[model samples]
Target: MKTPETLLLNQEQIKSLITMKEVVEIVDRTSKDLGVGKTINPTKVLLDLGETAAYPPYSGFMNAMPAYIGWEDSAGIKWAGGFLGERKALGFPYITAMILLIDPKLGFFRAAMDGAYITNMRTGAQTASALKYLVNKKKIKLGLYGAGMQGHTQTEAISVLFDIDELRVYDVNRQASEKFAQDMKDVVKGKIIIADKPEDAAQGDVIVCVTQSKDKFLKNEWIKPGTVVFPMGSYQECDDEFILSADKIIVDCIGQVLHRGALRGLVEEKKLSEKNITCTIGEMAAGLKEERIQKNERILCLPIGTGAMDVAVATAVYNKAVEKSIGVKFAFV
Candidate 1:
């Protein structure tokens, strides 16, 4: 019985489509099933914009990802493609994306969504999940660098699993830093202090660098011992010393890392081998391995971005939406 599926939900209906709780559950379940791995082929495709000033240098790029996700009992190929880079200059956004959900059985179009939040939160929450296991359970402060796209919600995601005493925020864009601090104070329920320099913010129990800097804005010396640093914004910024110095290099999926994530740069630089990666965060969460070996140490957690997570969140949201008939059913399939 291959009946046409004509369910079409608009942004208004899907705006509150995903939640933090759903995102965490996706991380937990995905960890249980896949054990933190994905098949990723990374590449850069150029674009042609028939306009002047060229708002964004790149547009219409695609990342091909085919994944075997366990918890969902579904295998999928979710494509991350769009004209995102140019959106920012048009006063829109930096990343504009859509998640294609397939019906593992029939190979039908189940749903497509604005994956902006899905991409941001899942990656951020994966870092938070690593922190939940890696960071010492001491009530300490947090420092966030480049408090934009991925930084703001990361604060909230970390708060869900741990208690943060205070937050220090820094960004080259002063307004972003100030706004992030104010918002964090209200939401994180902790004191928010703005940092004057990158070094100032790095001095914390946990330091998260979520910037767009191509260079190493965060110096290795600035990293304190036993600090959990998440330099998720750019690749290779942490450098050889930082990689070698980190007692533990935890990642969401080593496959993605090696393919083209944080660890790829380390490997290209000959700083790390396959064995150098301490372990996937899933192993620690699942009790297959341990985290934070000693009190005086530093660890790095990086999640490149996984479709299994996107599917996990989309599944949860879809289920809830179906329960209440929240989405609109269409006649055209």
Candidate 2:
């Protein structure tokens, strides 16, 4: 008898197997499942490595995220790391990761694949799902802060879900903003404009912040009523006033949002509490909680990037790869 094999897929192979539309669909379904108590996603575990006194100022950390989707009987874990101020020296990405898929019934390892792409796309897809429920407008003016990898995917996912008349992008690096605008013009029909400041981008119909800044750049005054804001960059990009002023705040996970999500600072500052959050995006998607009831209401969504998304997307990708015979198979046991 032949030994069972595991599929190994690289970044390009994973990209070829998955699409933005498919990501949105799977993430949306996972969120709905979460609302109805049909999934198991544990709180992410982190190990913080403080910066050293090196010439390049090296700082490092690692994290492990695990999840199980009950509807699909799929499970997996994603192990990722970040090395700030050292990517150029190391000739690698600032962030890197891999996902390991498991057979839920047999508890056997089934596949392993690159996770960086999955992380970005799933984060964007989750935001896109939030928009479907939180933003009532069919046509919107999209604003993006930090036009990099995450920004590109967020724009891609949102464009697939909404009709954007215009896209305003802002980055600390003017060249990056120009490059982003030029790159995205072919993908989305909306006119892309480079903004001079983060405030300019915050005033759009749908505002997404994907920067790595530790300081708050988005102010309460910059956000207009009837706008849907996604603070996906954790608590780093949004000010306390901006978070407190929202009519409704929805999070991907209540446990994570309270501890590490966009509201973490507000929660620690004693300005906001758990009661302030209206509901999770899961609840809204499952019809357990109310959505945007008024056009003039300002709604905010903070998704901390759940492992359920990773597992779901990975499972889908693995199944597709198997069907298309796109990845290498190696003996596992």
Candidate 3:
């Protein structure tokens, strides 16, 4: 009898297996599936280790996100962890994670791979999916509030979908924004400008805030009436007023958003409730709800990042890797 082997895909290998364009389509379809109840994405389980003597006043945490997509017959869980103090002291990334893909029928693990890149790309793809339904304009002036990994992918994903006439980026570290412009110069066919302030970056047709700041830096007055805003960060860059003032608020998952995403603070404070949400991106994608009906509607999209997206993209990547024979194979004894 032959021993079974499992596929192992590293970050670079997985990157070569998938493209941003394909990821957008996958995430878009996943949203529709979610709307139609074709997926199971449970709430992410989080474990927080409060400040210790070694890292006093700082904290570490880990989260387990699990999902199953019925249409694709894929199931997986992403396990990720991060420590703020370690990032600052060790000069390491704040988050690191991996995904384990399960054989839906056999009930065994089939593949394992790094999930950090997938997480960033899928998040951007989710934003693109929301933009497809919410933004009516064919061309847009893009405003970016952070120039980190998420910002880079957000710009890449959006530029893949729409023609960006102008891209204004702002970051506390000027070098970060400069690097972003340089890295994307060949990719984005538009004028890329560095903004001196967050407000300057917030001025555009479509604004995306991806900062990790705990305090709100985006002001409602800075946003134009017709602008579409995507606060994709972890409820860090937006305030209650900005959220409440939007004409239509769309979320990836209402349940997750209310407790973990941009709306978490508002929900906890009783300033906003699920009733205020216009609809889930899934609902809009599935045609169960209307998209931007009015030209002047200020639409805000808050996607907390879902586990179903991880499974969906991971499944696609795994299939592609198998077809291309891209991953390393190890026998399971």
Candidate 4:
């Protein structure tokens, strides 16, 4: 098959092409497919992502996660992660990533789209889908950790799906936290507060953690018995206590989480047992598991993050860009 024109869609174009509803729908279906046992290989792409005083000015790396769909997707689209930066960087994003949809027949590349916005939306959308399956929509007091892109993205989706009236947020950088509060206040028309500590925000009806801190954000005591905790921040964001305390635990993929995700810390320390974990967010989202159980059940949702999400979101962007002719077309034979 001849390769079609390679469209280059920038961030703005991609942004206009998608809406929260579409993303939500994609997430719902993707989660269900995942729950039904779809195989997606999401390879960990890492480059020394840490600010170093040494050579290369700012020594860092951009991790690229490439994922290929198997069984569920006959399109053979492979999505990858885009991140550029190192830890403790002054003003550089840790990851500068993108996704490439390929034609499996001849290994032809279909499209290359902006990844920063793509990554944030997919991750946030995944979390929201988890909330749909794990949290009580009636109770919507949300506490968010880290006022970064991921923080706002998650909040944006949450505001639409749940009747979230108030969001309590905190960040090491006071400005980032304050900015997030103000910006989200503008976007959601909901109540917003700046938190002094992670614990202060813990009591929210739905607490979403989005920081990149290595240290644990919330204590087990901080986690309410019946609250929904969505940890979207650190790779190992939650403390053992909070992780272990949840009546039900959900991951995007146990294989992914066990390797380098929010649950790795607990899994490594032996604080959380394998039996304590119930299902992946996709599995729960897929309807394989009943959505939001008894009010008192402790539900913790950790979107292990998957390639299917990237492919789904990217596909959305690609179709939109094509429809609007927003992207540049490239021809490479």
Candidate 5:
């Protein structure tokens, strides 16, 4: 009998192993797997731990996301937690997570690695992948809301696919947006502007909101024709009018969106359903549905960030690690 061992990788190790472009490719393939029904992804189970007098003085939430990418023969689960207070007090990241990759055939754990990088990359990659079907232009004015970690990744990933002629960024903290512009100027080929208001940023050809704000900030009036919008957060960052009035609404997963996140409120209010969505990004990627049929159509892309992507990326990384003899491996049983 062969002894089993599981590879353990830290954030730095994993970062060295993969690139954002690689993650985008993995995410695009995972979407295709999802479209072809080769993926098993359960709705994320969230544990809302209200403000507790714990190590961090913040209302925190944790999510258990389990998924299987049958096409890749990969299975894994991501455990992620978010504590907003840590950012304000300790200057710590708001989100932290880990992923466990399992051997599907043998049902044995293969690797354990940091999930934060994967999480960030996949989130941005979702938008980039979806945009491949949504946008047809080469040069675009990109609008970004929330100038934080997500903002950076979203810009980085999108810059890989399209030439951002202009990047207008907005944040509640003006300094953060300024910092974002300064940091991303080299990445964005054209220009970086700090928007004075959310609406200013919303005027881009491609608009994305990655904020945690519960209150709606994006208005339908601010949106222009032929624009693709990505509301990447759980809450209602965009008003009901904007979500409902869009020419087409596409999501990563209809069930995941309805169960929780961006469009949940509309579902709960009996205003939206799976039928209302035009098609998933995956479906479009797989050629099962049409995307960007009209040049002037307004599109809304809700990518809730699926675990199948994590599984796919993690599995690929694990295989590479084994091939290159990277990371530490410990005996199992």
Candidate 6:
């Protein structure tokens, strides 16, 4: 037998092979597969790389996220790293990583590709998938925090779903928010307003927080009735009360949510648990569980990112790359 070849793809190659609309559809399909138990997706495993001789104090961390999707016959692990302090100085994004795809049947490494583009696009697409099943409104006012890459993609993905009358953008760095508004001016059909305060961004029909802050900045009272809040960060961007007091709470994975993100602290405090979770977003999308029983019900969506999502999207990108004869392929022992 000949040695198997593994494909190597860069960020630019992957970027050329996928789009947000395609990713949203892929996420929708993958969520259903996940919901019906056709996938194996575990909670993220974290590695805290604390201060080292060469790195600064409280330097950075990495997460190992692995999963398998039976329907697509895809398997992979995403090694996601976050080194904001060092990366900023190096002029790199805070989070950077790669995805490794395996031949599920043979258990051979098949491909290694840039994951940052996939991460940003899929994160936004995941939110869009959740909104597809959770929201009923045709138009909305969106309040967004963390005017960064995530903020830009979230708006892009959401703009595909509803008519936005206004997009309220907020960031602790005033320049970032202003830049976001200016950058998105032509892309976003709705008027973009840079909010002076986090609270100012909170008063909206749909609220999304994607900041890097570990501190709880979003107040519970700022959230209105009949709103859906998507907290897309790894830590508590919103107050614990915001999650505990919501009418419904859905996540990418119950185990993952409990282990990290907005729900972790609450779980540790015994204020929340698996029982408090209404269902996975996959369940809602798959129609296995009901969503949005009442318009006035406040819903919280915590999607910390999933390997299943990565595998599914990555698989698509890989297939496209192969069909179009993109990327470099070479044997590795």
For residues 1-333, what per-residue lDDT tens digits would candidate 1 score against the true structure?
655563555545665766675687677767655553432222222233411125545644455555545556544444554443556557775555566566777776666656666767777778767776776584767888877867877887888777778888888988998877766776676678888877788777888877656576777888878788787753455656777888888877666677454566668777677788888777787777888736678887777666667667666666667777887655344
Off by over 4 Å in 6: 51-58
How would you encode candidate 4's per-residue C-alpha lDDT over 227-288 as one tens digit per residue? 87777754667777767667877777666667565677677787665677787666666666
Question: Which is the winner by TM-score between candidate 1 and candidate 6?
Answer: 6
Model 6 lDDT per residue over 1-333, tens place? 676899999999998999999999898899999889998898888887752225436577788999998788989999986776666788889778899999988888888999989989999989888888887786778999999999999988887777788999889999999889988887677899889877999977789999888789989999889889998987888887878789998888988888788898889999898999988988988899978736678999888899889888999999999999999997887
Candidate achieving higher TM-score, 1 or 2: 2
The runs of at least 3 residues in candidate 1 whose Cα sits more than 4 Å from the true structure, single-residue gaps closed, are: 10-12, 36-61, 81-85, 330-333
| Deviation (Å) of 228 in candidate 1 | 1.1
Winning model by TM-score: 6
Question: Whole-model lDDT for model 2 versus the true structure?
Answer: 0.85
Which regions of candidate 5 are displaced past 4 Å?
51-58, 86-88, 293-295
Error of 5 at 161 (Å): 0.9
Taken over the whole model, the C-alpha lDDT of each candidate is 0.68, 0.85, 0.84, 0.70, 0.87, 0.87
Q: How do all models score by TM-score?
A: 0.87, 0.94, 0.94, 0.86, 0.95, 0.96
lDDT of 3 by residue, 1-333 (tens): 464588999999999989999999999989999999999889888666542224345566667999999779899999875667756588876667899898877767888999998999998998888888877787888999888888889988987799888999999999999999999897678899999977888877889988767678888888878788888766548767778888888888777788775787788899889899888999988889877736667778888888899889999999999999898988666
**Candidate 2 lDDT, tens digit per residue, 1-333?**
454689999999999999999999999999999999999989888666643224434576567989999878999999975666657487776568899999888777889999999998998899888888876777778988988888999988988898778998999999989989888888768698899967778767888998877788888888888888888874458777878788988888888888775787778888888899889989988889878737788888888889999999999999999999899998878
Better of 3 and 6 by lDDT: 6
The better candidate by TM-score, 5 or 6, is: 6
Query: How far off is residue 2 in model 1, in Å?
Result: 3.6
